[model samples]
Target: MLSDMRALTHRVRLDRRMTWTALLVLAVATLVAIPFDWFGMWVNCLPDGGCQFARNGMLWYWPAASFLAYAAIAVLYVRAARARGLGTRVLPYAITGAVTSLAFPAAWVALDAYFSDHPYPEGPLPYWWFVLDRLVMPWGMIGISLLVLAWLERNPALLAFAAGYLALVLLVLPMGDGFGSPHFGIRLGMALPQLIVGVVLLLGAFGFRRAARRPR
Candidate 1:
């Protein structure tokens, strides 16, 4: 007996069948967001003529990218599903993403508050502690969102992407983002990791589409 898609599951992974074109657009959106670290409003202009290390860049970048990407994907996914006479739900993921985006900021605030309540007595705070906030940092909402989406979809590519991104982030954290340096090489070097990830995403879109087509 032939059963409709609705019989398989009440709610579908609408993005599971995302098109290459759609993926490319999503990739580009993510790629576009990589630069927010460079010119975000969440900057600390230091007296040294260089930007201070403030991890708030992710707050500007990820939310903006997510909004744009999710908005596009929502419309496109629903339109495609309806065209095929299949019902779908976007609200679940929307709610999930919204919640996920706050994970980093919330944790940061909690930690910041805790530290404020109990300041370091003798020595300075660990550098690593300060290096975590933006996507380039030790922790960021974009990373959190990526992890959440990866879990939701169980998408290996997204997982791999997150791992790769983290590797770059960890590598860059110690090197600093040209905070007090007046060298272009230092700043560009810091941004290079995200650029590579963006390129990987852009190129990986086609590969992901092809891989999805293989019989399981």
Candidate 2:
């Protein structure tokens, strides 16, 4: 029985270590990638048509792809931690991420159907839809941030991440293209901070999971 207990303790320790490693990796990745993305360093393409308006522009594709990747990683890591009997506090946050993961496709289809007519309907649907859809990404991030705040009060990285994104959103609102503009579509220069924020939330989710797994 003591041997079995020792083995179980070892497994738990290993799992805890793995959780910490994942959190560190996620945090470092977020910090490293965000600067490159925010400053437009990772891409060789200029904002000029030669790059920005190209058929397959890296600037446009990068953020869209990266956000999706972040969503996937966050959901998977949270679920994995929960399955291992760790980070139960993060389950709701994981569900939020999962829903946000689907928001992209759902928004795409819904927007296509709603805006099929050039003039669109003469109602509040467009306005509300525009506001709600745009809010979905932020909502997911906020959920994760709150979860981190609740569970890992010592680690302020996720809170900082959420705050930075919120600040960016406030800064960009005045400069934002109207609802008629391709604001909903992939616009890297416009959405870089948001993509980075999504990434931070993802990384923070893992960090929160790590904190949750630690023995009191």
Candidate 3:
């Protein structure tokens, strides 16, 4: 019996180690991708600097990163869920996160292509569709990120911080009188809030990890 118990303990430790290693790799990948312009390939600016390029850089980046990050979290959540004997509950979230991650980018690229060639406000597309295509999609991506954090059972403080940051982003999205108005101020506002949120999330993840490792 003692030998069996020892073996189980060893297995548990190994599992924990593997989980931590995978989480670390996912975290690093997310950190790297978050800042880069992953959707630049989809955009092409014309000489006139008109809607030729569809300069929705923030519109593209946030959703792309959110999807990727959430997919990672979903994986972690699945492992945790399985360990806790909640496989039925966790599998759906994991699958949804992965699907949404890929779908978000595809949708953004599709929108960019459609708008770039057709021109903005062509009269065929309704204004509400435009709002959905621009604002709703990005905010949905942020919502996915929050959902992933909730799945991971992250620290409450971290969750609150993310919530506040997302609220700020949503507020700012409509405030600039559409895109590129007061370009510098809009850029500053967007970048600064994201930076703050990213830092806070990182710190929170670290804190959660440390607390998890501590003996109860």
Candidate 4:
């Protein structure tokens, strides 16, 4: 019974930690990513977007969200460690999260350097790289983070949201040609994942708290 109580206590603490994490991710996604790139082309590209086109063309907007995310993550790990009364396994998770978030953008930078002098003729292609690079890659990062968090907490609400978000991504992925379909379809598709995530976190915040407390 003592062991079980400790486990529940730890789980509850995690639920609390992740509840805030969910809110943070959503906030940055809305405030940073949305206002910066209202076109939906660059939606949810990472955990930080500075609410001002924080990605490639406009990285200057990043310091705002970056500070918040890092600070919250620091507080999250500290509180989680204290609550668990154990060594900080959460450190690894936090580091891994940061690495995963940076994976795409970092790779893009390195590859861009290598391909700068490509042999192929380099006129701007009429098509946009938004769907695959900007949309899918960042969404992929967000999805991975969500799934990992859900698995850790074993929270049904988080899992359900993650599943639904991925399904929405798949449904929208093929809407624009190069990926096929109408242009508006592409935009709407791009918009929906971010929108749905925000709505889910808002409506299901309580559900997340309740479900996470159970901590299967």
Candidate 5:
């Protein structure tokens, strides 16, 4: 009985560590990627420098950033589940998120192609698709990240990350409308929620780290 209890304790500790480490890595990767996203935003400011052009640097940068961020979140979910002996119960959600990650960039390309060529005499696919590609898809991934992690563990930091991210999606994102506005301030405002999420997540990650190190 004692041996079984010890093994269970060990698994719990492993789960805690793996989850915290994953959160830390995700936060750091996002912080690193922010500059690239910012550069993309800056490029959007140039005259006729919209991301619709294949030549636009944001086409390269933003997608790369998205890949890194989502990849980390996926790994976190898988590893955390394995640590807790959950056997990938949440893996499907992670996989779905990974697949949907491509939707945004694909949507961007389609929009650009249709607009540039004017192939359809119709009014250029539904504008709501732009909303989906810009706001729904990207923010949905953030929701997935929170779900995967929070399902396993709930900490102050995790809650903060979720709250801040949802605030952005619900409040800030609509105001900026995926940075579609011509106004530069509105575009930059798009970054505010992203930055808030990263900062809060990082704080939570370190908070977990400190708690783990505390002498039991």
Candidate 6:
């Protein structure tokens, strides 16, 4: 029994295609859960902040669109990894990206529930929840940055472009108002550093890919 378990672990570790497929499935499942509010049980409000919107509208479609976009990218990553022979390292990075991507949305639901009753206008909720929410952004950024870094290690040029894209969004977008405003400069601050890291990672990945392609 122990030997069987070991063998299974070994197989999973070595099977890059299977690992990527699992990552893709995990990403899809996380995406599906977003609209349903399954990450944490709660009601969703419309942009007008009226009665909960029906499940079929933009509330569902927008997130679904986002999911589809990420899913497509994940598929492409899997294909590229396979062609390039990336193994278990890809699995860790993929998992990190998946978990990181889900963090903010998941925390938003919980924070909403906490804040709904207490109201930010009233005093803040217990300091812990506030701290947790603050932590989520950094934690999520790190996870995603790691994934980007991993990709950069595999394909520098592609990741450099992605980093540039992230930089552009950070610089140009009117994400929010002031420091107190949720949209303020926080995301830009977090993203800019990550993009720089991503550039370095891109160089590494490009080197790795080139080395992999060279004949012995």
Cα-based RMSD of the predictions, in order?
A: 5.6, 9.7, 8.1, 8.6, 6.4, 11.5
lDDT of 3 at 133: 51
Angstrom error of the Cα, residue 210, model 5: value is 3.2
- Check candidate 2 and list the clashing pairs: none
State each model's CA lDDT, in order.
0.57, 0.46, 0.49, 0.52, 0.57, 0.43
Clashes of 3: 0
Query: Each candidate's TM vs. the true structure?
Result: 0.59, 0.39, 0.48, 0.55, 0.56, 0.37
In candidate 5, list every pair of residues with a backbone clash.
Answer: none
lDDT of 6: 0.43
Q: Per-residue lDDT of 9-31 in model 3, one digit per residue for the tens?
A: 65554333323322343345434
The C-alpha stretches of model 1 lying farther than 4 A from their native spots are: 1-16, 19-26, 41-51, 55-58, 120-186, 210-216
Residue 1 in model 1: lDDT: 25
Residue 112 CA displacement from its true place in model 6, Å: 0.7
**Which candidate would rank higher by TM-score, 1 or 3?**
1
- Candidate 5 Cα errors over 4 Å, as ranges: 1-17, 41-58, 69-97, 110-140, 152-164, 172-187, 214-216
lDDT winner between candidates 3 and 6? 3
Candidate 3: the clashing residue pairs are none
Q: Summarize candidate 4's per-residue lDDT along 54-165 as a digit string, tens digits.
A: 2342233333444446456657756765776643334544554565556566656765677677764488643445434543355455566667766665566677877776
Tens digit of per-residue lDDT, candidate 2, span 8-125? 8656644532333333433444445444434443323344523222212323433454355445545655676678886523444444544554564565556667767666668556
Q: Give the TM-score of candidate 4.
A: 0.55
- Judged by TM-score, which candidate is best? 1
* Model 6 lDDT tens row, 50-95: 3231223222433344444345556665776677566434444544
lDDT of 1 by residue, 10-123 (tens): 235533455444456556865675566656534455576765444366456665566666667667757877887775555555565566555655666787788788965578
| C-alpha-based local distance difference test score of model 4 | 0.52
lDDT of 4 at 99: 59
